[model samples]
Target chain A: MSGTDDNAIVAARNFVASLPHCRALGMVVEAAGDGVATLSMPYSEALIGDPGTGVIHGGAISALMDTSGGVAVLSHSTGAAMTATMDLRIDYMRAAEPGGRITARAHCRHVTRSVAFVRAEAFDEMPGSGPVAVANGAFALERATDP
Target chain B: MKRPEPIQVVKQRRDAALRALMNGVPYIRFLGIAFDRRGDELTGVLHYDEKLIGNPGLPALHGGATAAFLEVTATMTLCWATLWDDLEAGRIDVATLSASQPTRLPKTIDFTVDYLRSGLPRDAYARARVNRSGRRYASVHVEGWQDNRDRLFAQATGHFLMPPRA
Candidate 1:
């Protein structure tokens, strides 16, 4: 509920919006600032994996966590406006509930000279059930002054 | 129902079998992913679409799309092995397979993806190698490339829990 106070948040918001895959998956930035970013994707029939159960696909959640982690890394105050995922590891804890909005929250755990570490989780807006998936990632940070 | 040479039958309907496999998962279809089959090998194709671009400034494909494509390749390769074996054993046919309810798909226990380069704005292809496959477990490594096969943009290793065999 706060306006952009820094270039990092603005860049992260623009990055998320301009991403075609984010639009394709209906990802929205719920909150972003201070080395943390949260995104939500509304459920749709097009995202279903099993037509029988109408559960969202694991691959879609994979996309969500990856982007969320990337956003968190980019939003950090590390003087890096651009970041590329070096590697990401995702574990599926459970299938996302059908017809439920899925939210992915990511925190930048640390930043090295050239890499940022991120951890992300996806929740399907269902109480009691834990995260649908969790992701650990490392991203290559590129500052404007990087040689 | 009619008997035919196993090799000949599998060769005759390999594409149909692949199509049937894709039909099993709605997400694969939603992503517009298709398969290219040669004997037992499969190459997953993600054709160029404006919706797949993650970095519009660079005009690059989304990392999530790339990951999904690789993951689908990994799991489908494992699933295809089963379908191939079943076909060779004369346990299934194209018609029955296609008409049957969507079969089970492997469940991903964990997956790790390495993005080596930005995915260019074009069609990308991936092929998965099953590192290990048992009755209940499978491990696969998949690589995605565009324009040139030697220059890979992304690769993934995944462990999947195989669905119980019917």
Candidate 2:
């Protein structure tokens, strides 16, 4: 990795770790560059929504997607120092298998003056099963003010 | 002839059943969100905890946590509604639900969250309204607020696939 890539990765790590909830959920940024980001969270007992089924909660998956989407916007070429989720629509395709890491990849599709559009997908590493959930989101960008 | 159930008895039974249902979900327990039951309505409270902060710069509640809070509220509301008939008929009660774990909450089909405002670092409350529910499908809308009911920080609409009746 080049110096700039190292800096971006560091920034992404800091950006992700800053959120306590993300830390609590054990999210790690696997890669980031050019308006894209990939993050993963390990399966843990605390995230289980149903005690009997032992399946992870949809909320945890959404949280991972939401954070990853926001990070994607921040990593865009015209990077903004800050961004917030304006709206997000998430579809649950299926439940993730227990004891597997869930990974989410987000792409920053478009960026205008004040808003950036992003799409994200969360899936288990298991091949052929496809995504566990997919999301389309719009995020607000914050630019620096004039001196 | 059997006398009809008194109002206090009904309220107690409902509260107990809801409590058991809430406790059954490990995620809800992890988030420390508790439900407050009113007559036919349930309010979800995401109790403020330092670990919930998303943007430490602003020290605000994580948007994801807020989303989860709203989703949990909507889901429990749907579950309660589904079990209402059984509750009224006295076929289901707190003891039976806790013992058997018979009630299976509906599976979420899709959910849309509109972030109205940044969630402040404090306790948040949410209530859900069922838009449509039938034999196999249910749609619900939920709103979350902190200090005042009129001012909302977030809202969501979710579609759920109801489980088969036992």
The estimated TM-scores of all candidates read 0.93, 0.96
lDDT of every predicted structure (CA atoms)? 0.86, 0.90
Clash pairs (backbone) in predicted model 1? none
- Across B24-112, the per-residue lDDT of candidate 1 in tens digits comes to 77788878899998878899999889998888888888888888899989988988986787876768877877785776788899999
Docking class for candidate 2:
high
List the per-model TM-score of the A chain.
Answer: 0.92, 0.95
Could you give the DockQ of candidate 2?
Answer: 0.81
The superposed Cα distance between candidate 1 and the true structure at residue B88, in angstroms, equals 1.9
lDDT at B80, model 2: 90
TM-score of 1: 0.93
Q: Evaluate residue A138 in candidate 2 and report its C-alpha lDDT on the 0 to 100 scale.
A: 96
